[model samples]
Target: MQAQQFEKLSLLVDDQLDKPQSVQLLKSVRHDPALQAKLQRYALISQALKGEQAAVADLDFADKVKQQLKSEPVYLMQRKKSDDQFKKTSLAVAASLLLAVVGFYAGKMHNQVQTLAQATTTAAAEQSPAEQMNAQFKEYLQAHDNVWYVNNNAGVKSYARLASYQSR
Candidate 1:
């Protein structure tokens, strides 16, 4: 699935299989001439590339590898210290960016809350009961501006007139 995985599989194919297992695999496919030809072609290619086929013919590869290991040992040293340092730096940078985003949103939310509080206080100050009643009365008077009051000798009476009254 990954280049690393493919490389590991290739290493297994080239280096890990026992000679008997390799022979068994080759023999299993020997009936298929095309498969045998392909194996021979790859063997030749490997021989040509490595210049070690003659040595392979004389020696058991797995035993030779084990003998070489007994003679000259190998150890893997840890080298991820610098890589780990870089990872920590990357994590710190990401954390700073995340904090900046949160701070920006918090600042924006704080400003919005302040503005809302100011607006509510302003609205409350402007909405006294007396002021509301006066506004309603003024609206009613303006809507009925064409009406008139008449006082007759018999009784107080009301009349309608087309004259309009305006208020500021």
Candidate 2:
């Protein structure tokens, strides 16, 4: 058969063709013995491809498995559906409760941090300029308190020079 006819036969086997296309192909296949044989071959190929993937491993594969099962002890464990359902429900409830608790604590912590920040800002706003300058100077001194103890010998000299310049 020609490639186009073979392709049409494959499409018919797969039911990929539209109603009109399928109807026309079916009519042509019904009239021609060659088309009929080609259609059957295509169908067999498609069935084999699908079946091989789904169930069939090789010749006598199922028979071998059946023989093996017959020789082995059979396991017949009964499942308790109630136990499984309860476990699933309990796990879901516990997870939701945990999430709620975490969310509540996070919101509480965030509020506490915001309130503390706001109080500090308010206090800073109340401070006079001189007071603010003194606070800044104290913070600077605390930050650089360890600078004079640096490994380099120039650290003390550098700090003294800076202090002198500031005083001047």
Candidate 3:
């Protein structure tokens, strides 16, 4: 048979031919024994391909997968109780150590400030009024000299620091 005749037979087997085209192909097929044999061959090939798909689907693939999953060991993911307890204990100990260090520094500073205040009071009592005023003025001048660097700096923050110490 010619290639065009084989192609028309394939299109007919696939249901791709329109009604008029199918009628024309059928008319040609009626007169040709070779075309009838070709149609039977195409139908056999199509049925074989479809049968393979149906055969595979009928083999119970889903049921086999379920059986495999049921045979596997179940696993649990979680930390042990002892590890959680240890983490909480370590965190508490670290917080207590931090508080203790902070308390020690605060108490030490408080004691030093009290001692300095007592020393200043005792020194002021020993000096006469005129000597005390002169001593106070000298201390004030020394304090001002300590922050003299602020006078040359330029910024709102620098002026703020200077203003806080200006009167005292």
Residue-level lDDT tens digits of model 2 in 40-144: 677778888888533334434767999998999978999668888999999999999999999999999999999999999999999999999977876776688
* 31-94: candidate 3 lDDT, tens digit per residue: 8878877877787787787774322232346678999999999989895689878899999999
Query: How do the residues 1-113 of candidate 1 rate in per-residue lDDT, one tens digit apiece?
Result: 34443343344346776677566565655555555444455555666778765332322466788888899866788765688889999999999999999999999999999
Candidate 3: lDDT of 143? 85
In terms of TM-score, which candidate is stronger, 1 or 2?
A: 2
Best by TM-score: 2
* Candidate 2: residue 94 lDDT (0-100): 100
- Model 3: how far residue 159 lies from native, Å: 21
lDDT of model number 2: 0.79
Q: Which scores better on TM-score, 1 or 3? A: 3
Off by over 4 Å in 3: 1-79, 136-168
Q: Estimate each model's TM-score.
A: 0.33, 0.40, 0.34
The alpha-carbon root-mean-square deviation between model 1 and the true structure, to one decimal in Å, is 15.9
Q: Is candidate 2 or candidate 3 better by TM-score?
A: 2
Residue 65 local lDDT, model 3:
92
Give the TM-score (vs. native) of candidate 2: 0.40
